[model samples]
Target: MTDRDAFVARLGGVFEHSPWVAERAYDRAAATGLTAGTVHSALCQAFRTALPREKMQVLRAHPDLAGKLAIAGKLTADSTAEQASAGLDRLTPEEHERFTALNDTYTKKFGFPFIIAVKGLTKGQILASFQSRIDNSPEEEFETACAQVEKIARLRLQSMIPGDENA
Candidate 1:
């Protein structure tokens, strides 16, 4: 693939379901002559500058931790792998029931699913976070979700891009 094609193909998965962020990053890189050293930051900037509605859409695109998608095998490859790494995919029936309840409550309360970078967290930590964050104000939760999305994107980018030490 061409350099641009390669970038789009790889970074397309950085945002949960938002390829526009990757496309914008590609444009920015071309316009600014961004090097590999700076591309991740550029992609993050693209996400930051996106419209509010688009940002919300990006946030909503994330699957709930151990939600139905995981159970149904419908999660994206990255999401499946992340959840598995966090041991969300191995939850017992009781734990799964708890997660489902929490996910439902969180979505109803905040109008979106609870999102976290599950890369290094255990299922228990994730459950605690979900429980605690459910009480946050909508505005607070919105900001927190956005930050978590950014972290997820950063991790995805680091894995897809070679030698991204700062990712």
Candidate 2:
């Protein structure tokens, strides 16, 4: 595969189903360089410049935290690993019930699943964030979801690319 193609294939899932973000980032990186930080910035820029509908699609593409897909083992590999990192894979029966209830409430409120970059956070922290953010205005919640998606993309890029461990 060409370098650009390789970049896209490896990073496409960084924004869930939003491979266009990876494609745009790769194009930008060809003009710049393939550093993790550069690609992350380009990906975020692509997301920021997307049309409102596209932005909503990106947000909607993410699976609900500890929701059906995770239970069914159908989450994307990146999502599965990130969720596992936060101990989401090991939820007790009571914890699973709480997550399901919270996810339902949050989705009902915002018309989209609650999104938090689960890396470096405990399940309790994630639950607290969900409870708090569920009360945000739809506009505020949309913006917050997009920001969290960007953080996920940044971490995914940092992991896939070799240099700039500090990025």
Those runs of model 2 whose alpha carbons end farther than 4 Å from true positions after fitting are none
Model 2: weakest 10-residue lDDT segment is 158-167
lDDT of 2 by residue, 44-150 (tens): 88889999998889988999988999999999999999999999999999999999999888888887888999999999999889888888999999999999999
Please provide the root mean square deviation of candidate 1 (C-alpha atoms, Å). 1.9
Local accuracy of candidate 1 as per-residue lDDT tens digits, 8-93 = 78777788888888888897766765444467677889988989888899988999889888899999999999999999998899
Most accurate candidate by TM-score: 2
Candidate 2 matches the true fold with a TM-score of: 0.94
Please give me the total number of clashing residue pairs in predicted model 2.
0
Candidates' RMSD to native? 1.9, 1.2
Q: Provide the lDDT at 81 for model 1.
A: 95
